[model samples]
Target: MVQQRTADRDGTQQKANHTPWLEWVASGIGLLLTLGIFGSIGWQAFDDAGAPPAIAVDVTRVVPVEGGYRVEFRARNSTGSTASQVEIEGKLAGDGAEAEIGHVVFDYIPGHSERKGGMFFTREPRQESLALRALGFADP
Candidate 1:
């Protein structure tokens, strides 16, 4: 009986020694994976911080002419970057209402300028200077 008990004890010790160390390894790998995901998110946040803001726009003038209205405009990048494919909207403000009369497109270089001509509009006969609203910027 003592020999049989000793054999059982030895068998128990053998099983304990063979315990799966892979579980410990897997746990460490999981920890590393979690840290990697968090680090990636943090890196993305930092990158976004350095990115420029949206474009800013301005309208210099809109004046009535013989055949049409002349539109003079300017666009600026407040984010300190070059803005391209810009769409500017001009509106006429008169007759108790404001109406979008025209749209134009141009590229605004960063810290520079672009001038456009041939802005024409047809107005009703005997009309005076039309009130104008102008909005300009790079595409969203």
Candidate 2:
């Protein structure tokens, strides 16, 4: 009987293809890794610190009293953390406004609260101006 033989170099056996699925699998994994990296950076940039903090601002009212409007606000910090600083700003609403109120700052510890006062106006601001509406907290 006669025997059949396959071709070989130097009369030795041939080697099979190694890592055939490596290229495809590696490409898919690389794509997923890039997407994950970008997603994490975007989420971090959008996250806010004082947003879910322990302090919050509560504006009670803006009434025309005591010769001018009295703006009352309450600061409550109950998230077990203290607010380092809080600021409040206001401006008169009218045409060609000249009066601009600056921000008011306060500090509070955890579980403690404070009330903001002396947000007074020298004269009655126009009710129709946008600035007036903003100071009145009517839009927000």
Candidate 3:
């Protein structure tokens, strides 16, 4: 915004002034917007930080592959915190056959979120004896 306007002696514009009306308004809006976003994020992080990750793993599906069985599983984190390097272990034991163990590692599971991965096993898993559980995890 121009605060002053002057005309030259020859009837041409010679002086112009800029007022920071728009600049101040824009800066205020930007500052408020940034504060709102960062404030919410900070509050959320503070609330969730004290909680630990509660994770569980379950076998969703088991299908036969060429050389082994593909066991698809789902890992869920039900707490307010996240888990990293989550280990899921699977055990398959059928009557008279030896127990076959398989494991899969999930990269990360966010709080109250789920992730899917697959493990390979030489023996097919039965629903009655198939065991799927969260072995361990690192805090993220």
Query: What's each prediction's TM-score?
Result: 0.40, 0.38, 0.69
| Top of the candidates by TM-score | 3
lDDT tens string, model 1, 78-109? 44334566665655545554543667676554
When sorted by lDDT, best at the front, the candidate numbers are: 3, 1, 2
lDDT on C-alpha atoms for all candidate structures: 0.56, 0.52, 0.83
Candidate 2: stretches off by over 4 Å: 1-55, 65-67, 109-118, 125-140
Lowest-lDDT window of 10 residues in candidate 1?
Answer: 125-134
Q: What's the C-alpha lDDT at position 38 in model 1?
A: 93
Instruction: Give the worst 10-residue stretch by lDDT in candidate 3.
Output: 1-10
Residue 101 alpha-carbon offset, candidate 1, angstroms:
1.9
Give the per-residue lDDT of model 3 (tens digit) for 22-116: 98899999999999999987987887766888888877888999998899989999887889999888888878878888878888998879999
Better of 1 and 3 by lDDT: 3
lDDT of 2 by residue, 34-57 (tens): 999999767655644224335455
